[model samples]
Target: MRPIDEGMPRERTLLSWRRTVLAFSIASFALARLALAESLTLAESLAATALLVIVLIVVISMRLYRGSMSAVGVSTFIVSATTFLLGVIEILLVLKD
Candidate 1:
């Protein structure tokens, strides 16, 4: 792989992944807390499950692609798109309430 400016690009990429994981962690905990407080509707429960699955996918992909920049980038893109989709699902849940 071509090195770029003393690994700044790599650092940024890792940081982005860290941010995504942290955000997903927060969302997962929130969902868990909500689930404990009251019964969630089918849609909400599905959303929570999907969110968890996406989190696992992201974590696994990141680990698997640690040595490959292009592979990690593709995984990041997929994870990002799914995260946005989850956000939309959350919005719908709020609207339905």
Candidate 2:
């Protein structure tokens, strides 16, 4: 049987991860739009790659969250941080015009 309070924290964490995914999706869409407007092939490719990485991170994060593994949670946080950094880089590159 699951503890009563456990669900609350887990649910909150999951919601935060979902928000992260949504934010990344919006950023990726904006980057794509900017890339298309300026004919930036490299920016487009980098943004796509970052978006894919974010998707992969979200998948791993879901698994980690479900399993309640602290070790994997740390790894997920690291992956999310790196993915965010990559997304920032993509945005910067796209705006470097």
Best by lDDT: 2
Question: What local lDDT does model 1 show for residue 5?
Answer: 56
Taking the tens digit of each residue's C-alpha lDDT, what string does model 1 give over 49-83? 76776666666656654653345556757777767
Question: Once model 2 is optimally superposed onto the true structure by TM-score, how far is the C-alpha of residue 48 displaced, in angstroms?
Answer: 2.4
Off by over 4 Å in 2: 1-3, 68-96
| Candidate 1 positional error at 36, Å | 5.3
Runs of candidate 1 with Cα error greater than 4 angstroms are 1-5, 35-65, 68-73
Task: Score candidate 2 by lDDT.
Answer: 0.70
Best by TM-score: 2
Residue 3 alpha-carbon offset, candidate 2, angstroms:
4.8
**What C-alpha root-mean-square deviation, in Å, does candidate 2 show against the real structure?**
3.7
Q: Alpha-carbon error at 34 in model 2, in Å?
A: 0.7
